[model samples]
Target: MATAVFPYLPADELKKAEDESNARELSWFLDNLQEKLAEFKHGLEDCYARLSPLEDPESSTLVISTPKSELVKGHVTRVGTRVVKGSLHLRLKTLPSLHLKLSETSPLILPQLSHLRTLLNNALDCVDITRWTGDRHSAAFITSQLHLLHSLLLEAQNVLTGPSFPVPRPGTPHPLPIASRTSGEDGNEHNPPWYQCIPDPNTFAPPVPENLSLHLIPTTSSLILTIRVLEPTAVPPSAFNKFALAIGAQRRLEHDEMDGVFMWKGEEVKVKEKVRVESGGDPVLLVLGVKLQSLEKGIEGAMMSLRAVMGLSQEKDDD
Candidate 1:
């Protein structure tokens, strides 16, 4: 017989969990923000000609500073493609007041927008992998993105927030705890908030891209996935050179326990990230792949095996 587990947690205990989760999330965002700023600064220095259009002396930079509110906090916005040639513009807005728009050519904008989209998607993906089982962290992260994307969609055209895109919703309660909250000295309740792009259930499914393929399998504890990347014609040859997929597991070591191994008849396991970089300066793309496997054994053991495979593939790419 299977042992029974409680679904609803005690109110006090749930509150405590939320507090701890928020701290960790805030830390992750701060670290990523620093890295993003550095990359933007360096790109500006290296390609001034590519971003010249946005540097017009007549245009004034707009600032929309306001008190940090639940709906407007942690929002990031950027402008990639413009209306001209040989110029690129980038605008990053994390809050209502913080916004920048650079006027540049289409080529410059495309690459920058692509990179930014990758980063945003990667961040959300990390949150998805870590908070797969519903909790406050998952809600906070997803909520922030929804609000951010909604605001962007209102003013611009973003494929991710398009009608075809579907945002994952919380499911039945499990062992994982939901996000927590903290109280200020003045006794005000503070917790990360959730935002919806368009509250209607009808508009939730993500628009499918012609080249993107998704595979999902349900297991005893969690879901196993294999994502195959098909090269898009719009992406240049150089953009196809190096491809890396980063997997973030919620319970890093518990991966195996949740999804049992198919080959060994054991528990599921988290695979180590495998990065493949190609040789030669020419523009050739590879069929990139990401697979989450079951490892009856420990996490370290599985990663070692994956590293070996990646190394061998890299050698072949070089040859």
Candidate 2:
């Protein structure tokens, strides 16, 4: 019996079994493909709905502000990646009290916008695939495409709520903020936008005075306004008085509110805003301790001669 036994199988029967197995595999793959296709279809529909509107131009009021100050304000009308009509308002005290009003009608494009949008659209283009053979490779392709679409979709959503900033107006001597800006009228090579007394803002902190540390982060999100006020125990000494940089002294008095004004650049800057006068005729403290202009219009204007400053690089937008 052992000698008669053979280890071989019938060729036709083996082939038939293989065919059935292949059929089952193919069927399973088709089911997986269908699920993937349905998911992709729904996702694509949603992505297009959001992205399509961005193609059409939109205009917005862009404000670059900090937790306690407004650094820049502008009216920007954008058509896709570049500003079609816009203006930048900058008030640097080193200048001769001139608020830089850089107006732009020419397009000022950012390189970032172009690259990001190109990547996003390429994902959209992937929808028109040559073919998927309903195999493992096709599944992988579908997975990769869907992953890309999902990633960009999330990134795009974060961009809609803007933390705005002032970009340089096109046609200026320097279209970028960090670039050395020559006076357009004078065309002098030696004259930079900032004054001689101040170190280049691109490299060093501006000439802000001591006592109050003026740190302008200049990144997308940071600015320091650490006011060095005297502690309450130290307030009575001759070195410091009730009014001079007293810590927590400027807390708004809980009394009848009054309006006041201080002069800046020949403009009557509004002050004493939301601050109530104390019962003893003591000057009500402001949100600002020693830094008086810590007032809204003041620090916001960054019109501070000794005040702090901050800014964000203007971001490129695809619409």
User: What lDDT would each prediction earn against the true structure?
Assistant: 0.26, 0.31
Cα misplacement distance, residue 59 of candidate 1 (Å): 25
Which regions of candidate 1 are displaced past 4 Å? Answer: 1-10, 51-319
How do the residues 73-94 of candidate 2 rate in per-residue lDDT, one tens digit apiece? 3333433444344333333222
| lDDT (Cα, 0-100) at 37 in candidate 1 | 31
Poorest stretch of ten by lDDT in candidate 1: 282-291
lDDT of 1 by residue, 134-210 (tens): 34334344334334433332222222121121222234212211122111101111111111001122111222222
**TM-score to native of every candidate shown:** 0.17, 0.34
* Model 1 Cα RMSD, 1 decimal: 28.1
**Per-prediction CA RMSD (Å):** 28.1, 21.5
Error of 2 at 219 (Å): 12
